[model samples]
Target chain A: MNALWILAVNEYLDGLRNRWVAAAIMLLGGTALALLLVGSAPTGTVGAGALEISVVSLTSLSVYLVPLIALLLSFDALVGEFERGTMLLLLTYPVARWQVVLGKFFGHMMILLTAVAVGYGAAALFTVLVSDSGTAGWQAYLTMMSSSLLLGAAFIALGYLISVLVRERSTAAGAAVVLWLIVVVLYDLALLGVLLADHAQQIGPGLFSALMLASPTDTYRILNLTAFDSVGQAAGIAGVAARSGFAVSLLLGLMTLWVVVPLATTMALFQRREL
Target chain B: MVNAAAVEKVIDVAGAVKRYGDKTVVRDVDLSVRAGEHMVLIGHNGAGKTTLMKLMLGLTRPSAGRVRVLGADPATAGAGRRRALGYLPESVAFHSAMKGREVLAFYARLKGIAPAECRSIFEQVGLDRAADRPVRTYSKGMRQRLGLAQAMLGKPQLLFLDEPTSGLDPSLRRHFYGLIDTLSRSGTTSLTSSHSLNEVEARADRIAIMKMGAIVACGTQAELSRQAGLPIVVRLGVRSGSGARVAESLAAMGKIHRRDEHRIDLFCLGASKMVVLRQIAALGEVVEDVDVMPPRLDDIYSHYMENVQPQ
Candidate 1:
């Protein structure tokens, strides 16, 4: 356990020295502020509070950005160390293979958490000062920020799984990009196409919920946008959100599983790897 | 301080075989290194030197047979048990963004040692001047020094260094062996792998030459040289006027490899080297100076590597 903590701190410091933390903060913070400023124009016409509207807008933004950032941060974690030859020396020490896996997870999650909190926190603070938003607005905004982190964690775990499965960093990078496109971009479009073409009304609410839960990004979107009445109505998903029938706790549970299953699989595979 | 009778086998491998699929990387091999012994594994590339080292380090388990280090199964040894072992891999690397001190401290921490002890290790490997510099700015030699420093941390009882001197300058290579000698004197057992036979000739307590995933020969330099039965060359610088006379008089002694006005090279078996030398001494003033050359580690290594047929 102590070794795990040391490795975690080492990885975190490496991220800082590599300027990954700084870059993630700048990218997330810059985009969040941009979406907050230009996107708040619709609040007056829609008759929704500023924080609630921002939550709706940011949910759309995070579904694209969070997974992209998370995957980029973690795809090279294992394979890069193997290529650089650091992993060989590291394993020579008293550390177990699982510690190496969890150490990287905890460290990269800290990076993502920092970016999400600071970036979305600034936007939340701005919304509070400028608009007469209420407790409900603040509640919805906090949900958005935390769920975005969970969403990021899920993707980071998936990236580590990719890292462990491939032998080369180049292959891991290619796999990560393909995984991102399938989960974040194409899954939703394909779902839309399938639903539209269901002239026989074959796809039911249960099947739709299962389909949405299949992709972590969609699961995160369902959690943040549909869990609240004002946010769901403002994002124009109230009809679908009402019919989806997924409890907030169940969505949170599914998000946690997304993080756990892939990370556990990564640990098991890395244990048997020669390096 | 450890007595000879009380000496332990720090590393023991018996009938160890490692196969990656159908291709066997480490054949049935048996090796043992006593405590305080400096054992060097010399081999060509893909000769399984690194694989053997990995087996002993617990990084890879053998497909069949046993590997024990410090009297424990290396593959399943606990963290506390592994603290006694140190390894420096071939072409060691660290996070390029980390400082030298930071890299050492990271390993020190993993070994449960205080980070403050990193200062003394920096001085040991002569990396103190570059302690604060990021590894990205380090040259290959400096990086190797840093690698040596990390392996020397916690005063480990066993050290496994794979090609530790590959990229080092001659002086740095000497310095590396000097450090190994210092550790050996203090009762640290080291098993190092190198393809450079000349560098380790005088340093290793015993040499194991590996080829095609198996050990062909292993012993002290003198012992292996004797067993190989290679000839000893005796070169003599003759007086200006006696080149012809010296060659004629020594014609029946042994094979005269080369002879000229300035020198004569004669090759004789080890058993007959002194007999041949006495014949030269009989012509006292005709031989101006005599130099006896024993079979070098290079010759012995080549003899074994070339003689062993591939399985």
Candidate 2:
């Protein structure tokens, strides 16, 4: 096996053993199931489709939850190894610095993918079993799941960037939480506040779409809620989707950029790092 | 592998300087190790011993100068070249959830050794019985042994061990050094850093004493002792009430240190050792026993460190 594969496999196994990962997986799975079963009660009464309603709810859930989970899983990846003295021993082996960073990136990405698949996959299965939404519903749900994974990849990359930038595990953790708050919670709130204050003048559609694409969660929101007619109309983003003029390909490209740029920067910084 | 006819330089560090910002961790350090040589680095904490070892292993690039391990710059060496080097950090830590056997196998695969090779290495490091146990369950000494087991994998031509015996018991320490000895005999060049001077004194072929990021002294025990100019101590066990008499008689020969009423230690240069011993023999009945102590590595280390310290 390649050395990078070995390191990645070890990282994946190590991540599985962590109590926090287990808890996060459970939390996501349980919340996703609950949202599908209990939170979808209003869909039946309101005459809205169950899959459409759950899509909206689950997208919001992912926006808040997936990035947090990704950050939590990866914040300590690099700095923790350095603090624990494993990085020194690891670097001594016949492995390149880029291999280490990429290995860890893939490993953490796999963990997040597994969590999202099992957590959100089970919920999507439940929604499909009970609902009669047909192909369009399944399409939107699949897009949500895949785009959720992409959003997670972006955050995991950002977490690695934080891991390499900081000197201590505690510092990386603190930076990760702050980053999560900024991208997930505060960025949207601040943007909404800006849009609300500029209601008279109105933010331009082009500038508005660019601003939304700045945060991975917003891009994820736009992708899942705007990709389809039924889900987009139900989620109240159809007008924003029509005005934003973002193709599925373009939004996906932006998310890919989010994953690659931070990872590339992390590799570059880690290469020159003293440890 | 044990080609005694042709000597191979495993590690060559020339004028290597490592700086973290303005503070220099390793400065103008030049060192070389030959195949089958067991070199021990002794220094105080923060003496750049670990940093120097990192440079030799190519774990970190020197800010200036050059470091070549196995005739290639460690910082730029390819995977094949790096596969020939092994290192055990001062504090060895592994994934706590991993079984000892699994951890060794992973490292073995990274070093391009067959997974089957891990079994023998486990036995070699005395970690066979605990191979299936999780690393979290192992004690500190067990972890150290596990680290050694990994470092010894693939029969690395050059091994860099930083405080390899930190938490080992006396017997395990002996076993560890014996393993190094066995590997050395097989032409594996080993560079080990240690604070346990007395234990490493007998095993190390050459000792390099580092202080404040520089090699203040480097040589075999005898050579270092000669360079330090430290005297050998001869202690005499005198009969009761004869301590004062022996002290006065020994005072004329050389400097005398009264250990207690029953003993007096004589400090004499190497040349005057026999002359002092002959004088002590003439006072035969006054002295019951005599212990001629040569300068130990600890003494030589302290002497060199003291001389290097600014007044």
Q: Which tens-of-lDDT digit does each residue in A1-275 have in candidate 2?
A: 88788888888888777665577678788998987787756564434466777889999999999999889888998999899888888888889889999898878877877888788778877887777764347777878888988998999999999999999899999999999999899999999899889967668867887898888888899888888877877776677767667888999999999999999999999988876
Which model scores highest in lDDT? 1
Q: For candidate 2, list the clashing residue pairs, or say none.
A: none
Best by TM-score: 1
TM-score of each: 0.94, 0.90
| Candidate 1 ranges with C-alpha deviation above 4 Å | A45-48, A134-136, B1-7, B236-253, B261-264, B275-288
Give every prediction's interface RMSD: 1.5, 1.3
Highest DockQ: which candidate? 1
Q: After superposition, how far is residue A45 of candidate 2 from its true place, in Å?
A: 11
TM-score of decoy 1: 0.94
